[model samples]
Target: MAYDLEEQEKLEALKAWWERYGTLATAVVVVVALAVAGWSGWRAYQGYRANQAMGYFEALEDAARGVNGPGGADAATRIKAASDTLRSEYAGTAYASRGVLVAAQALEEKKDYAGAQRELEWLVARKDQSTLQPVARLRLAGLLLDQKQYDQALAQLNNPPAAFAALFADRRGDILAAQGKRDDARAAWQSALAAMPANAALKQIIQLKLDALSGA
Candidate 1:
């Protein structure tokens, strides 16, 4: 009789403890389960997006490569189509930025300078890809220089990133020289020479340009 009574008391204690805490325990379990499920879903979505973006990038490259031959106009059209797909579906991906750059290069090769400018300008205005901005600006400045848009080219070189300082100064020299600002051009060339990497092969070319300026 004593053993039976003790067993009954233990069973009752367990029931009371469960009644007090069962709902809280159930809620914690549900929260943990949902968190784990959500994390897995997010990872899966990222993988899908990466794979899809890669496919679009591959198509873009194929189109860009095709622009070298006889049917180059058709290839350019295809490049535009692929670029549009990348921008529309994978704008957040690096592939989107790269596709636009590739399209710009193709347009430039085909002498469609206006089209190239539009593509490069779009990249410059996109705030999400901060790293590509300087490159786009540099290419755009070069285009402007080629078109004799000297002031516009200079404006793009203003306050460039440190790594591109030498290139920017070199381009500035070219623009100033074209405008007959000989003294400023010479100074800009000197700054470019000073900023350039010591071991760069282009240093020899820059030196030649500097010598020419001095002779002029």
Candidate 2:
């Protein structure tokens, strides 16, 4: 009987404690649940936006294909329109960056370097995944190189991540070669060769650069 009484007393104590703090505990649990729900909802919204962007891009491609005008400037305009839609409707998605790349390439093909640079600038401003950012930076650097903006191009290529470092170095060498800095270009090419994989095709290309630079 005594043992039974001790167990009953402990149960009563537990009940009282729960009664005193139960409301606060319930409120905390509810808040946590709501927080999780909100995060999930935001992710869902982002995913939906990405899907919408893909649809818009497909439409834009179709528009480009059917576009008509002298010099394909009409196609450039269509691509720009699609890019604008992506910026307005899905700016937070990876598709937005992709749209920027496509529009920039189209503009570049039309000899609209300035317009292409502007799109690249917008992409640089966005928060993108590591892989995408490096690719964008590389392409932007190439555009700068085409404009003979040597300093800007070199700056962009100087600090790429490991995945892009070799290509960046090779581009830097190309820029140096264009600027008449043969020795510096050779050194850069050597660095590129060291960084690049030892595939036969790549090795042959690097050897050619070395031979050309050395011969010159």
| TM per prediction | 0.86, 0.78
Using lDDT as the measure, the top candidate is 1
List, residue by residue over 1-216, the lDDT tens digit for candidate 1: 355878999989988989999899999999999999999999999899989988878887887887878988998888788888887788888988888899889888988888788878888888888888788888999899889999998898999789888988888888998899989998998899899878988778878987887898
| Runs with alpha carbons beyond 4 Å of true place in candidate 2 | 1-18, 36-40, 63-71
Q: Where does the lowest 10-residue lDDT sum fall in candidate 1?
A: 1-10
Error of 1 at 185 (Å): 2.0
What is the Cα root-mean-square deviation between model 2 and the actual structure? 3.8
Query: What Cα-based lDDT does every candidate model obtain?
Result: 0.87, 0.81
Alpha-carbon runs more than 4 Å astray in model 1: 1-21
In model 2, pairs of residues that clash are none
Model 1: how far is 36 from its true place, Å?
2.1
- Poorest 10 consecutive residues of model 2 by lDDT? 62-71
